[model samples]
Target: MKAIVKGALAAGVLLIVGAGIVAGLRGSEPSAGPGGAPSSGPPRQRTLTIAAASDLKFALDELLKEFRAKHPGAQVQVTYGSSGNFLAQISNGAPFDLFLSADAAYPRKLAEQGLLSDDVFSYAVGRLVVWVPKGSPLPVEQRGMDALREPAAKRIAIANPQHAPYGRAAEAAMKSKGVYDAVKDKLVLGENIAQTAQFVQSGSADVGIIALSLALAPAMKDQGRYWEVPLDAYPRMEQGGAILKRAEDPELARQFRDFLLGAEGKALLERHGFFLPGE
Candidate 1:
């Protein structure tokens, strides 16, 4: 009987010890490091990928800085390119949470194709401009599109109208001004408006039709002079944005969309020389 009692006591002690260890472990925080300090790994953050039009390159950069400041735990990555190409990629399953197109037509098409989580909405109106490097021999500002016809203006850069909205606008403007046929031979196409600006700035092209927002950016502002293409020269460049149907976080995407449509976003767009829709 004494041996049996001793064995039972040992078994009970083992059970109690095991329960205590489990309880201690369950109640304890993560393991500590040297000096008994709790280890702090990187904080978890939600990430969002925004596919935006090239015209928004500078504006979006500034807006995102403010957005991250407002939501410190949120991470945003932007890919700036031609809106038409972005739409095609998104349709083909590009992993983008948001799409901001330079023209509303692309987003509307996405909506029609069931690629959008919600209805597309206008964000801003884009403006096109003719940019010539400062001190260019051709008087682009005074002569406008006519400046391209100057002998010194041998090369002119414009975004590829095949996929870039700004390029289409540039083409339309030139056509309306009756200069397209004359200047078409001298045209050098950039992949996007940003690249078009670079072509002029880098002296690869004597002139470029680029986004007004880009011309207003500090990098280009000091290096060139621009003449805003009259709004009537081309159709309105209504820019739009939408959340993708396959977004990883629909609510987060919606928040971003709302932010862009909100006052702060509108103010930023205006500061960047973009006109709000209906303005």
Candidate 2:
């Protein structure tokens, strides 16, 4: 009985020591947050992939610089190409979070597929121009698409109408100006507005039907001049932007979309030759 009592006393002491040790460890454990937030893990971050039209290269390059400055840790990747080309890729299941088209047609088509909401938003109205390199034989002061009908214009540059919204706009403007039939054979199609501008800038083609924003860029402004196509001549180039339904970061994509529609964004777009919607 004496041995059993001593054994019980020893066990009781061991239990007390173990309990104290557990209490000490518990005291050392980090306190719970008021709402159970992690106290030590790194902050969560998100990345967004945006596909924009090539004409937005200059403007978006500048704007994105500001966007990152505003969002220090947000990851944003932009892919630029013809709006139509971007649509084709998106239709093929490209993993894009957002798309800012150079025209509204593509976004409307996407919305029809239920890949986007029916509520499409117009962001900008692109201007079209006839641009020639620094010293091409083309008269810098010539007005209208009629310039393309000039006998000296043996080879005129244009983007592929079937794939570029701006190209389609250019074609429509040319038809409205009654110059398409005469200048059709002389057409040298480019892949996009940038490429069309390149055809003229490189002396490969006499003049290019290009986005006015591209023509007004620093280099082009210094080397070339353009006459705006009368808005009445062609359908408005109502550009639209929307977030994809399957975006990895739909919320972030929407944030960027709102940013693009904000007043500051409109000012930037105007500075780049994009007119306000309905202007």
Candidate 3:
């Protein structure tokens, strides 16, 4: 019996030693990095998801490219839509890390609902424009808002004023110019500003009231010509951004917010036709 017991103990010791050796070998192997490069340790990967307004589409795309260059290990995903819709989503506990609104009011509303991690800050002042695609029958530059009254202007697109800030501004501008009542019947509502631009670009609408930022985008710049809507015609389109309370990566969210308020971000916004808050 003693001989049998001794043999069993020796076998157990050998198995334990073998397991430890295998574990050590596995641990010594270098880990894979982002692009499958050998890493001395586990690489850090962080991701942030942002919900933004449609007007930010172009400028934000450029900003993200620069941001990712600076934060090589971080990934950012953006969803663009109407600010009011995003506000409703975040209020209901959407898993967004940040929210960039077309109007400060939406972010302020979120903050009031206690859904934001910090106070909202104005990032830019969005401008509205009257856009007509190339080869359109109406003389947009010559007639301006009056072009919508022409028979050739059968369909005019504007973001849904019920939710989109740009839409509200467009309505306000038309009303101020004494054209809203005249063009009301010709208006076709787009779900958002980007879609409003699409409506005109695709010839679904004869013209559109859209964000100047989108008009300045390379895709749209040559596709159409735009006339800036008089700034005084509507309430200021003060845009804002904030970090969400439920952000999985709060630090990253804050960094990105700061980046938007920084020099590079301001420059991009300006190039895309957005005005700084004070400007």
Best by TM-score: 3
In order, the Cα lDDT scores of the candidates are 0.80, 0.74, 0.81
- By lDDT, is 1 or 2 better? 1
Please give the TM-score that candidate 1 achieves against the real structure.
0.84
- Candidates arranged by lDDT, highest first: 3, 1, 2
Off by over 4 Å in 3: 1-42
Pairs clashing within candidate 3: none
How much is 250 displaced in model 2, in angstroms?
1.6
Location of the lowest summed lDDT over 10 successive residues in candidate 3: 15-24
lDDT of 1: 0.80
How many clashes in each structure?
A: 0, 0, 0
Which residue pairs collide, candidate 2? Answer: none
Off by over 4 Å in 2: 1-43
**Candidate order by TM-score, highest to lowest?**
3, 1, 2
Worst 10 residues of 2 by lDDT: 14-23
Taking the tens digit of each residue's C-alpha lDDT, what string does model 3 give over 164-190?
Answer: 999899989999989988878888887
